[model samples]
Target chain A: MKIWCDRANNQRVAWHCRSHPETAESNAYAEVFQLQRSFIGTSPVHVPTVADIQVVTRRPADERPAVILLELPNRHLGCQTYPYDDLVQISRLCRAANIRLHLDGARLWEIQPFYNRPFADLARLFDSVYVSLYKGLRGTVGCVLASSDAAFMAEAALWQRRLGGWMVTSYPVLIDCERAFNLNIGTFERKWRKMCAVAAAIVQATKDFTTSDGRPIVYFTPEVPTCCQVHTHIRGVTRERLAAARDEVERDLGLSVFPWTLPSPFMHELDPDWVLVNGDPLAVQGMDQYFEWSITDKNVDIPDAVFAQGWRAIVTVLFA
Target chain B: MKIWCDRANNQRVAWHCRSHPETAESNAYAEVFQLQRSFIGTSPVHVPTVADIQVVTRRPADERPAVILLELPNRHLGCQTYPYDDLVQISRLCRAANIRLHLDGARLWEIQPFYNRPFADLARLFDSVYVSLYKGLRGTVGCVLASSDAAFMAEAALWQRRLGGWMVTSYPVLIDCERAFNLNIGTFERKWRKMCAVAAAIVQATKDFTTSDGRPIVYFTPEVPTCCQVHTHIRGVTRERLAAARDEVERDLGLSVFPWTLPSPFMHELDPDWVLVNGDPLAVQGMDQYFEWSITDKNVDIPDAVFAQGWRAIVTVLFA
Candidate 1:
């Protein structure tokens, strides 16, 4: 089994270098590629970046491909969706190559608000798309795989029957999921904005603050156009704190917020270049204020507290 | 396609005489046979019962079998959960042949209380057991297809994936189904006994009184069996009054109930056999005197009424 990843320019050196304080980007790359090769032969391919897989599928090589996947980019909060421009291009390529495109849309519902596209239009492009009711739809259990009636009828029933998913006698989970999907999904985009703003404030506040472990406070970088950034200092954390953070993030946003603390940033899921934001949006805002106050008292030429406060307020309202 | 029907003996005779009932049973069978010979390219053949489909699969004389289904003997609560005596024999035949066994176990859960067997143990005997979550479980909607995980992973998934069944997210449905499955099951037989006793008293008292429908009443009979003993003349009566009876039954018994009405006695499912006592148990005792007094002369059947009164005192107190 072969794997592929982007060997793009690093940020600290060139414009594209991942702009973080510690743990170089090269090491991140190596760790991710290594973990994925572990599950290379598994049915569900271990991918760290959707773009990485996309890059390979669109490699313009002459070899016949068996199956192609539409996977998520970084599995993180406020993680922007896969590149739509690249996605349509990939679909065209797969169609040209006569290859099957299967979508791993576990986060597909959450993705639409970020990408600014309708699910129906996106759904039409793939030969088959797999979406989990338990994920973005907020079901306790179950998943859906959709495609053309004939082609889908040929394989999915056979697989679900074989996979032990068909034994579920009734669909209470689906009904609950439907309510959550219909009622709560509309506000996701607004919430995403709030998270991004709060994350920006956090990094600005903690510009020089260190944690108990003596590492600089890490914040998410909204990798807008040219660059992407993830925070440093992953270790020296207690299990309690980690769990608390996950719970807080999920509760506040009413959705799961992963990238809580990964062994390596780029492992497990093929991550999209994300505008990393801390799950603790309120705490980030607080940190921003602290930085503004401390720096100004020292007579530093940093941005003013009023500006910081205004930024945080905007972020809070956006998420709210 | 060979079809196994319980009343196929009567059905064949009726069809030959040009006098079959409009029930789905007779019409559905004839249509199914037509489709088998034409659309499905298999000649329609009749079997006495589908206790075994192994016969046709092994001794395929000419045509491929269409669908081997039996007219399962109805208790007319829409359930026919027989003991292992029949099922185990059927399963052995299924295992030796390539034929798929599809259980029309719509109220399969009803069988659980009568014979007392684990659901999985019974499910293991069939290739695919179709269980409706609503019938006995009181779920709002949904059915389950239970089978081997290997079969699910191998064959069933392909069919589910291909069918539009893949489009549905299932968590909500499962939630409701499992909630009903966990909470609403049990006490069926206990309530059933109460209903049978009450019916026995009524049948003994009101020989001249016709039910809302014209059908005559019987306690538990061998042909109509236990579940259909409550058959009344009001089969097509408004659900408003039918529901009132349901509420009354619940009020007296404190258990839930299921109501199944059939077209006619000649239809067999309508044959008065047993009162379906699926609802609250005490409710019937509380309401039995009201029924006995209202339908018969108040002076009649003093001994039977006194006996019923004694039964009500014990059962309701025990239930309480």
Candidate 2:
């Protein structure tokens, strides 16, 4: 993708991206190519608005971005995505402005249930689409990049050879990727439905819950997830405390609640003036522990009540 | 290796290499880095001499090479290696000249039998050593680069991350490599001995043989095997004819003689003034077909007489 980006914007023109600063696109542009990037702002729902994109496109000719990278269901921002009509408008705006639009469809499979649209319909809107086989598709590590532009893809192949990305044998990885895709692709819609039900149960069960410190204990970022993933925030709880509670619940009840948690990026965004200690704002305030709760076919079969009970057990240990 | 070369030779200092232009070092430096390279001439045995090393190191300060890359038992040149004494002198020469020496030990295992030296002892001569896990070890695919220079290895690791060389899970490859090394490392000396005996038998059986065109039918490049590999050149036979003969012999007698053949690089060197037709000299004179006959434990069990018989059948078919 870096190579393709380099080739697409050979003049080193600025790229427009709404993804987080930690994403592969942001890192590659800043660290590898040293290319300028213009970020589109997200609405309250955490999805980039058409107005936000026009703001960058309205800039002077010298400042106009050459390419706009859109991530389907932005993973870092609670896997939020624009409504289908809004996305279509954004795509049209880019085309009218002569800016190439690329899709970082790493989690494209997850959003299919929300849009209820065919993969081709979503992919056709972008000039280039990159999909990860390992993400929602449950494949081994690999990705496929599709582009209508033959020259761009040819340059990508040249770069692949130059960078030693072409392996002598990738048959094993490809075979595993195919097997995983076949096994899990059909289960995503069901998984997404289960995830929403599970989130609703947790929100209902912990409606008025509060920490020992008198702070709201738990809440969902979007209140309703668009995909099989949702970000759950635990106010007045340190990441360490959350992890301990999760481990305790799993050990005692044999129910795993969350794989891991970290200090939420939104905490700093919501409170820009928050004090920091030792380079960590979370050190001064404990109301920011968050984790992305992702439901796969493996756990979708478990009733939503079981998940609510597991979260309740975790919170009990947290406020103990 | 490309990244390490870029980091080490930051000023784009010229490199010294004796390996063929098709080898990784030559291609990376020429095509990737666009760095200047100085070639050290090989002796009749196709091993770079200490005199060749001095010629490059003796250059004026402005033209002195930064690094000298030496391939163990140059795979393209009949798997020939320098006498242990010559290699020691070349290593000392590079050190005295303040030039870093790197070993392209892709075939390092093949040369161990000829040098009769410990792997560590041979590796310690150069500033950095690279060995392929797949070539002779029969592993899947991977290589290890070792160096006492902490900074160089640290830089290599950084490049590995930047280039996406680090896999999500390489445990399977590592496990297979370890298994292959354990199974094959001890049998190299025996394989080398078997390869020499087989080569001698082939030479003896076909010494006076001639093609229908009155040209010599076959000959070994070095006239003796240095390691488990030897380059066998078939005079008066095009690569196409050689391949057909090999396939026919395999089908009829159930004996696989040569896996594949190509016009030997040495042929062009031997007859630089040969007339060319359609960009290939072999089209004008079919006297250059050759292939590297690499002996592994799989073939070492087959008697030398069987191999000699196989070659004889191939040649008879080629003449007919």
Candidate 3:
């Protein structure tokens, strides 16, 4: 495990180190499993961090691998989804190595537009697949694991019980997920395209503005985002100004823009440039502020008027 | 592990075998861990099933047990809460043996009234304790683990993430649980006492009248229950009849009686005589002819008129 992790690039670090303040970067070496057995670190790839399992499987016959776990749309990297070629290569590598592959497709729903494939067809690449109902699926709380191996799934079920995931009453979550899926999944691709269009328009409209220091007032972390989600930064604005304008945007336009801070930051990336200004988002409100947002079925149809009002409010707060 | 399970008795099958039809009874020998490293089987004893540390500690000087796991208020035998003596003895044994003891206190709330002690004091007996929020606490879904060992807890926290138990947004559950704890925990003891009184009265009122085979119509499984919850058998009545009567009782008396089946029977006990009669009660229509109810704060003060009407409904449904 140590040997495999060491083979990765120097920049490779546990995905958690990005958000956990206590996690030292030195200790974030991309070890698959630590001595403690509990601290398995994540590989630093884009949202869909596809592993070419062959890289690890090339080891001596005596050191054959056990399992290869892949995240379809890695949540940490702006929900970046893997392409079919990456998945096919990994699948072939696992097949050759005779190691089981597990897909952590938490945000697989968002990947559909990029892949243009059925969920089941994509799932067939791995020995087992876990699709979350919450991330982008809008479930109250739930996930599902699918595989052709009945015995393996049964074992998974047992482990779920041992881990306290075997809920007494999960219907509330199940019902909510089902409803959300029915309402949202059908038009996700169209929504994604629409979102990309809106994002492009916003970028074009704001490209001319500059901060006092001359940096672009509105900047996209990735000049062109691959999916519906984009990490954004407003250079001249404090978190407080963005937050105040956030309420006004919703009031005037009935559309919500991303707040600089969220109660749960683990779900998003870590950006050090941002500073939390005011208000308690969680139990005690105070933490670094960052900006992120996604276009989904729910928000794909925001009217031009609303977007204009929201952008205007944000600009007014920062420049007025 | 096989030797220990074999000694427990033939009726001492794994708790799961009672419900899982695929699990053969003969194969139920309690193996502590399988070759794959998964732990299986529950102890056959009631609450506080203590193993004299001397038994294992006496083996070779090199052989030492790492941990002792105990389930307080054993679920199968009617949530039997452990006494203080049993807890003290187990704690002493664990300390002397140098083995960590963890308590599966899923129904710890139910133990408070019986032990007449504080929750923290009971928690101190074990190295770590897992208390459920959804069981008697009535939360949507959550649990709390208490331990003085920071490293061990940190390790456990890591395992929680690996097992997908580290949710993106658990505040929904946390907030609901907080609301429930505030509303319920304060007056739980008073409510419990009241419930016991009501249960006793119901038992007395419906004790007589035999079936065609001479079995009593309203029979308590244990004759007298050890806790607030009692498994009741309403003999010779169809599931539909009981379901109808259940609704009538709620409407006429504002008191609830348990339906024969629940959506998640794994959290509850196994009662083989009754079958899952119909729809998912958690989402839709209810089922099962068997009846069970608990004396809790919510229903402790059920009016005498309501109780009388409920009894009448049951008798009328069964005999009419």
Top candidate, metric lDDT: 2
Give lDDT tens digits, candidate 2, residues B1-320: 34444554532333223364344422544544455665566442355678878887788755666777788878877887778898889899888877778888988988898888799889999988989888889987778888998988886765555545664455557778899998888788898889889989987777668855565678886678888888888876777778888899999999988777777654344323333223446523655777887888778889999999998888778664
**Interface RMSD, model 2, angstroms:** 4.2
What value does the lDDT take at residue B166 in candidate 1? 45
Q: Judge the docking of candidate 1 as incorrect, acceptable, medium or high.
A: incorrect
Candidate 1 residue A35 Cα shift, in angstroms, is 21
Each model's lDDT comes to 0.41, 0.72, 0.55
Backbone clash count, each prediction separately: 95, 1, 3
Model 2 chain B lDDT-worst window of ten: B269-278
Q: How big is the positional error of residue B80 in model 1, measured in Å on the Cα after superposition?
A: 5.8
Q: Is candidate 2 or candidate 3 better by TM-score?
A: 2
lDDT (10s digit) by residue, model 3, range B200-239:
6666666565666775666553355555665555655556
Every model's DockQ? 0.04, 0.28, 0.09
Write one digit per residue (lDDT tens) for candidate 2, span A1-320. 34444554532333223363334422545544455655566332355678878886677655667777788888877887878998899899888877778887888888887989899889889988888888777775777778888987886665555555554555566788899899988788888888889888998777668855565677776678888987988877777778888898999999988888777654344323323222436523655788876888678789999999988888777664
Backbone clashes, candidate 1: 95
Ranking by lDDT: 2, 3, 1
Give fnat, all candidates.
Answer: 0.03, 0.11, 0.06
Worst lDDT 10-window in candidate 2 chain A: A269-278
**Candidate 3 docking category?**
incorrect
